[model samples]
Target chain A: MQFKLDRRVHYSKRMLIATPVIAIALAVLVSSVLLVLLQKPVLLTFHSFFIAPFENFYSITEIFLKFGPLLLIAQALAVGFRAKVWNIGAEGQMIIGAITASAVPVYLVDSTSALLLPAMLILGALGGMGWAAIAAYLKTRFNANEILVTLMLSSIALQILYYLLLGPWKDPMGFNFPQTVMFQDEALFPALFEGVRLNTSIFIPIIFTIGIWLFMEKHFGGFKLVVGGLAPNAATYAGFSSKKAVWSSLLLAGFAAGIAGMSEIAGPIGQLQRSVTSGYGYSAIIVAYLGALNPIGIIFAAFFLAVLQIGGDVALVSADLPISAVHVFQGLLLIFYLATYTFVNYRLRIIRPLTHSNTKPTP
Target chain B: MSTIEFFLAGTLSAATIFLLAALGELVAEKSGVLNLGVEGMMAVSAAVGFVVTFESGSHLLGFAVAGAAGVLVSLVFAVISISFLANQVASGLAVGIFGLGLSALIGRDYESRTIAATEGIAIPFLSELPLLGPILFQQNIVVYLTFALALCIGLTFKYTRLGLAIRSTGENPHAAQALGFPVFLIRYCAVAFGGLLAGFAGAYASTIYTPLWADGMIAGRGWIAVALVVFGTWKTGRIAFGAILFGMVSLGELIAQSMGARIPSQLLSSLPYIVTIVVLAMISTNTARMRLHAPFSLGETFDGVGPR
Candidate 1:
C-alpha cells in the first residue's frame, strides 16, 4: 500500500537472507492448492507435502540422498553467479561427470580399492570443469553470452553421455537397458550410515561449499571477481581482469557440478542410465538464486528442493498426481517466488482520482 | 523428412522464430538491456498461441494473442530489471522461470493434442522451381513476414532518426538521457517488441513444427536463438545465418535417426548447441568486434536516478 521499508533495516542482508524462505513459503502455498486440485484436503496435503518429508530419519536420509548433487550444483552455480557468470549447464555437466567417472568402475571393474573411488570422483570433477571451460573460454575470449553458450554446450555434454551409455559403456551382462556396467565395490561411495539410501557424497558438496564461501568472503580473489561483476568500470580501474573473473568463476562451478555428477553416479546410481537427467542443473539455477548465492543458504535450499522433488514423487503415488502435475506445482513455486519477490522489493500503489466525496485517507 | 525437404522446413521454421525475436533483441541490445527470458516468454507464448489456434482456428489471432502474452510476461521482467533496477540477470532468470511454470500449468489440457497450424502459401511460379523452389518459396506467410521484417528492422537501424536514437540510447544511455531521450521508454519498447517476436517464435514451434503441444515442447530452441543473437555478433544477417545453421543442425538429428544411422542420436541432437559455441568463438574472437558490435547498452539496467 505504501513505502513501508524500515529506514534502520539492513535491507540488503534481509533481502538476501529472506529470499529462500520467501520462495519456500510461496512454493508451499501454491503446492497446497495443487494438492487440493488432486482432491486432497488442503491442510492435510500441506502436512503431508511439507511436514511428512522431515518426519523421520528415513525421510531425512532421503533428503540427503537427493540433496548431495543438488547442493553441489547449486554451490557451483552460486560461484559463477557471485561473479555474474551464469553457468546453466550443471545437468549436462553432471551427466558427463557421471559418464566419465563411471568409466573407471565400468572399465576397471575387476580393480578394487578405496583409492579408485576418490580417483573417479576427482575425474568427474575434472570432467565438469573441462566441460564448463569450453563455454568459459568462449565467453572470456570470444565475448559470447555465457548463459546461452553454457546452456547450449550442456546439450553437447548430455549427448556425450547418451553416446557412451548407449554404445561403449553399455552393460553387457545386464538386461537390454541403455546403461553402463556397474562400478566395483571399491569405486562405490561408502555410506555415511547404515539402513539409509544416502551415501558419503553429501560431504563433498558441503566441504566445497565451505571452501567456496570462505573464498568469496575472506579472499581478495573473490572480492575482485565480485567487484568486477558489480561494477565493471571500477574493477577495470582497480586492475582486476574481468576475463579472469569469468574464467575462474565458471571453471570452479564446472568443477563442483562435475564432482556432484560423479557422486551421483558412484554413490547411489552405481550404473549410468539415460534417466540420469532429472533437471538437476536447471533446478540448481533456482536453488542458487533462491539461496542468494550463499554457501550456507544453498545447503538448506538444496534440501528443501530435494524434499519438493521426493514429495512430488510421493504425491504421485499417494495423491496420484502425475509428474506433470508436480511440475506444474514446481513451476507455480517459481512464479510465486518471483511474484512475492516483487512485493519484497516494491510496494504497489493503486492510483485513483482524488474525488472529494471519497477523499478519506485511511488512518 | 528428406534432406532437401527437411532443410527447407527447418530453415523456414528457424527464420520465423528467430526473425522477430532477434530483431527485437537487436533493438534492446542497441538500447543496452540484455534479456535472457526470451526463451521463457517464447515458451509461454507458444502454449497460449496453441490454445488460441486450437479454439479459434485462426493463425492471425493466435499470433496476436501469443505476442500479447509474451509482452505481458516480459513487462514483468522489464519493470523489475529496468525500473526497479534489480539485477538484470536475476530478474530475467525470474521472468523465465515464472513464465515456464505458467506455461506448463496453463498448457496442461493442450498437451499431446495437435492443432490446425498455418499452412504453406506457395508462390505461383516459384513453387515449381528446382529443388530450391519449395524450400524458399513454399513457406507460410509468417516466414515471408519474418524475412521482410528483418530487412525493415536492419534498414531502419542503419538509416532512420529513430534508429539512431535507439542506437545512441544503447551506446550511451547517460548521454542520451542528458539529451532528453526517454531511455527507459525506449528500452521498454525494445523489450516489448522482442517479447512479441519471442512469443510468435514459440507459436511457430508449437503451431507449425511439432503442431502438437507437449511439456518442454520448445526444447532448448529459445536458448539456441539467444545464442545465435550473440553468435551473429548482433548483426541481422549473421543472426539469420546462425539461426538457419542451427535449424539445419536440429533437423540433422532427425535425419540421422530416420536414416537408420547407428550413431547415438543424442550426439547429433547436440550439434546445434555445439555449433553455437564454435561459431560464437570464431566470430567474437576479435575484442574490437565484440566491443564495437555488441549492443552498447546490452544487459546493463538503467536506474534513471543517476548512476549508483
Candidate 2:
C-alpha cells in the first residue's frame, strides 16, 4: 500500500488547538528514552523538568523572571514570523540593546534622575532597531538573505560584548573581572516583593502581549502584514509594500528584543556581564513557533518554556543531567511540533494496491 | 619556510575544513534542497570524531563513524522537511539545535581531552621542491583528498549525466519529474552527500587540525561554509577559492598575535564573519547574476500529489 497526503477541505479547529499539547507529550516520551539511555532516573528527571519549578514560591518567581523575556521576544518574533521576515539575530540585537542601555548607567554612575531609566529603555530599543535596520537595508537594497546576515551579526555582537567587558567596561574598583559596574538604584526597576528578583519589569511583557494581540487581530496594518506573509503576490496586487512589511517586522522585533535585554540588565542582572543573553534570542524562536505565532498562545507557550528552563536547572543538581538536556528537549519539542503540525492542514490516507481487475487500460 | 610561505600552507589546511563542507552544500543546494543544519551536523561529527579517535586510536575509523552519524542526523532533517512537508527553515533550525545539544552531551566528559594529530603524508619528489612543495604537496591525507573531491565535483557537474539530472532537478522539479527524473531520490542523495562531507570536515577539524575535543569548537565555520556557496555564486571552483580566501583571513588572527600587532584579537577573530557578510552583500546585489546561478526551486517544497 502507498501512503498519500490528502489536503483537508476544512481543517478541524480542534487539531489546531491540540497540536502543541500532542507535541509536548511526544517530546516527553522521546526524552524519556534518552534519559534511559543515559542511565538517569526518568521519573525524577521528568519531575524536575515539569513539576519541580512549581513546588515553591521562589522557583515560581524565577519562572516568571525567565518568562518575561521569553514572552517579550517571542511576541516580537511572532509578528515578523507571521510576515515571513526571518530575523534570527534577536540575540545580537538584544546584546546591542543591552550595551546601549548600559551606556546610560555606565556613564552616569551617580545619577538620581527619574528619566534615566526611560532614557535607557529608549536607547535600548533604538540600539536594537539600528542593528536590525542594517539587515533590513541589506535585504531591501541587496536582496541578501536575512537568515545568514543576522546570524553572522550575532557572532559579531558577541565579540563586541567580549571586547567591551575585557577592555573598557571592566569594573575598575571591583577587581579585573570582565564585567561592568552594577547599576545604581535609579537605573534599576523596582522589585515587586521583598527579597525577590521578580520586578516591575514584568509589566513590559504583559503590556506587549495585549498590544500585539490588538494589533494583529484588530488592526488593518497587521492584516496587511499577515497577508504579505501568507500570499506575497496577493499583497502586492493589493499594493501593500512588502519592503515596508520587512522593515517594520524586523525593527519591531529588534525593539522588543531590545526591551527584553534592557529589562534583563535593569531587573535581575543589574549589571552588564558576559552571560547577558543566556540564549534567550534562540529560545524565543522556539516559543514563537510553539505558540503557533499567536499572541495569546505565546503567553502560555512562554510560561511553559520558562518553567521547563527553571526545571532544567533543578534537574542539573537533583538528577545529575547535563544542562544540554534542556536544549535537547527544546529541539525535540520543536521537531515534534513541526511534524504534528502537518496534520492540521492535511490528512494521511493509505492507497490500496491496484489489482488487475481495478486497473484501467492505457488510453 | 618564510612567513608568507608558512601562511599559504596554513591557509590550505584551514581552507580544507570550509571547502569540504561548502562543496557538499553546493551539491545539496544544486539539487534544490537547502539544509541549514550544517553547523549542527558538523558539531555532532566533531564531537563524535574526537571521542572515537581518542578511544580507538584510529582516525580513519573515527571519520567513518562521524560520517555515519552525520548521515543519521541529516536524515532527521530530510524526513521532516521533505516527507513531512514542514517549513524547511524551522525544521533545519530544530535539527541544528538538536545536533548542537546532542554533541555537547556526548562531549561533556571528553572536554579538554587531546588526541594524536594526523601526520602529513609527503609525496616523494614533490616534498623535495622548495616553494611549491611545502605549500601544496606535503600535507595530511585529508587535504589532498579534499582537493581531489573539489576537482571531481567540478568535473562531474560539467561532464556527467547525474550532474545534469541534479542541476535540472534543482532548476525545476516539476519539469524534471515530467522528464522522468526521480526528484526525491536525487535530493535525498544530494543531502546525504552533503552530510557525509560535513562529517568529514568536522572529523578533520577535531582529529587532525585541532587534535582536541572542545564544546562549540566548530563555531561559525559551518555557517561560513553556507555563505561561501553564495560568495562563490554556487560554482565548485569559486566556492573552493572562496574557502581559501577565508582561510587566509582566519590564519591572519594567529599571525597578527605572533607579530604582536596592537589590534584587538577579537576584531581579528571576527574578520572572517565580517568578510562573509560583506562578500554576501556584494555578490547578492547582482540580481541578474544571482538569477543565473541560483537554483530556481531552492527551498520550495515539492509535492507530487498536491492540488496544484
Candidate 3:
C-alpha cells in the first residue's frame, strides 16, 4: 500500500470553515492531557477556558475589552502578513504608540480639554508608524530582514519605555514606581458601562473592521497588495511597487497597533505602565493566522482569543495553572491550525496492491 | 587579574553562546532552512540544562540532556514547516512561543536556584604565560569546544563533499535532486544539527556562564545569534568575528554600568539590539553581495516534486 497527496482541483470551502474548529478541538484535547499530566483538574480548567468567560456579564464585557486590541492589531497584522512583509515587532510599535499618546497627558497632568484624547490618538498612530517606518526604511533601502529589525526595535522600545517611566515620567506624587501619572477624565475614553472597564474605545476596532473588510474585499489597492504577496514578480510586471507594499503594510500594521496601544492607555489602563500590552502584539499574530488573514474572520478569532485570555486568567486561580500555560495553548492552536490547513489544498490518497491474477495482463 | 584581562575573558565567554548558536544557524541556512525558533530552543535548553544539573549535580549530564531537548524542540519546527509545508516564518514563531512556554513551565520550580559555574581548563604551559595566556588559553571546556567546532566548520565548508551538497541544496534543490541528492534528508539533518548547537548554546548559558535558572534568561541572545549570521553574510569566519564583536560590546556595557557612568542601565542594555539593527542594515545594503551569500531557497519549502 502507498499513500500520496494529490492537489485538489478546487478550493475546499468546507475545510476552510471547519479548519479552525478542528484545530480548536485538537488543542483542547492536547491541553486536557497536559493538564492531567500536571495533576490539575482537567475538566474544570477547560471550563475556565471554554465556559467560564461566558458565565457572567462582567466576564463577557472583559472578553470584548481584550477583544478590542486583539482585533485591531490582528487586522492590521493580517494585511501585512498577506503581503509577505513580516512585522513581528508590533509590540515595539505599540509601546511607542502608548508612550507617544501618554506624552500628552504626562506633560499636561491636569488638562480638561476634550481635544486631548483626539490628539493622543493621532499622535499614537504617528508614533507607531514612525517606529514601523524605521524598519520599513531599512528593509527597502538595505534589504535588512524586517523580522529581526522589528524584533530588535521592540527590545529597544521597551527600554525606552522603561527609561521614561523610571526617569522623567515617574509619577511625582506616587510611591516612585516606574510608571506615568494617571490620565485625567478628559484624556480617558468614556466607559461603556457604569462599573465595567469596557469603554467607547471598543468602537475604534469595530470601525476598523468594517474599513479593512471593504478595503481588502472591494478595493484595487488591496488587490495590488495581495498580488504583491502572492506573486512578487507578477506584481512588479503589473507595475505595482513591491517597495510600496512593504512600506504600506508595515505602516498600516503600525498604525493599527498604535491605535490599539493608545486605546489601552486611554481606556482600561489609564496610565503607561510596564505591562501595558501584555504581549498583545505577539498574541495578535496568532489571532491573525487563526483567522487565515481575513479581516472579517479576524473579528471572530479576536473574540475567541479574548475569551481564552480571560479564561486563562480565571484558571490561574481555579486550576492553579501558570500564565505561561495560556501561551502554550495559543501556540498549540496555531500549530494545529497550520497543520490542518494543508488539507484545504491537497487530499490524501491510498493505493492498494493489485491481485496477482488481475496483474496477469487481464487475460 | 587586571581589568582589561577580566573584560577580555568575559568577552570570550559571552561570545561562546552566540558563536555556538549562530554556527548552528549558519549550517542550517547553508542547507536552505531557516529555523527562527532559536530563541525558544535556547530557552528550553537553558531550563532543562539547569534542572538536570541541579538534580543530578553533573553539568556534563545537564548539557547532554539540554542538547537533546533542543533537538526534540526543533523537530517540531521541522515536521510542521518541512513536512506539512506550512509557512516557515509562522511555524518558527509557533515553535518559538511553544518552547518559551514549555521552558517556563519546566523551570518554574527551579527559579532562583543556582549551580556552580564550570571551572576553566588551563593548558599546562600556556596558563602561566601572561595576559594573553589567561585571556585565551584558560577557559571553560565548552568554550574550547566551541572554538574547535568553529574551526572544524570552517574547514568542512571549504573542503568537504557534504558541504558542497548542502550548499547546492540551498542554491537549487531541484537541480541537486535531479543530480540524485536526497533533499529532504539533507534538510532534516541540517535543521536537526542547528537545533543541537542551539541546545548547546542554551545549556552553556544555564549551566556554565550564568549557572542559574531564571525565566527568560536566554533573553534575546538567540535573536542576536541569528542576526550575527546575517551580519557575517553567512560566512563562518566573519560570523565568529561578529560574535566576538558583540561579546565585546555587551561586556563594555556591563563595565560602563559598573564604572558609575551617568547613562541609564536600560539605555546601555539596549545598545546591542540597536547595533544589531544597524549592522544588519549595513551588511544587507549591498544587494549583490547579499544575493551571492544568502541561500536562494532560504525560508522556502521544497515541494518534493518538479520545480514549480
lDDT of 2 at B268: 90
Candidates 2 and 3 compared by TM-score, better number: 3
Candidate 2, residues A1-363, lDDT tens digits: the string is 998877789986888899999999999999999999999999999999899999998889999999999999999999999998989999999999999999999999999999989999999999999999989999989989899999999999999999999998889986888899999999999999888999999999999999999999998999989888777788999999888888999999899999988999998999999999989999999999999999999999999999999999999999999999899999999999998888888899999998997787877
**DockQ of candidate model 1:** 0.42
DockQ of each: 0.42, 0.84, 0.83
Between candidates 2 and 3, which one is better according to DockQ? 2
Instruction: Residues A1-363, candidate 3: write the lDDT tens digits.
Output: 976666788969899888899999999999888888889899999998889999999999999999999999999999999999999999999999999999999998887998999999999999999999999999999989999999999999999999999999999987999888888999999989889999999999999989999999999999888888778899999999889999999999899999999999999999999999889999999999999899978988999999999999999999999998898899899989988888888787788889797689743
Candidate 2's displacement at residue A125, Å, is 0.8
For this target, which candidate reaches the highest TM-score against the unseen true structure?
A: 3
In candidate 2, list every pair of residues with a backbone clash. Answer: none
- Please report, as a residue range, the 10-residue window in candidate 1 chain A with the lowest summed lDDT: A1-10
Q: How would you encode candidate 3's per-residue C-alpha lDDT over B4-69 as one tens digit per residue?
A: 888899999999999999999999899998899999999999999999999999988998999999
True contacts kept of each: 0.48, 0.72, 0.77
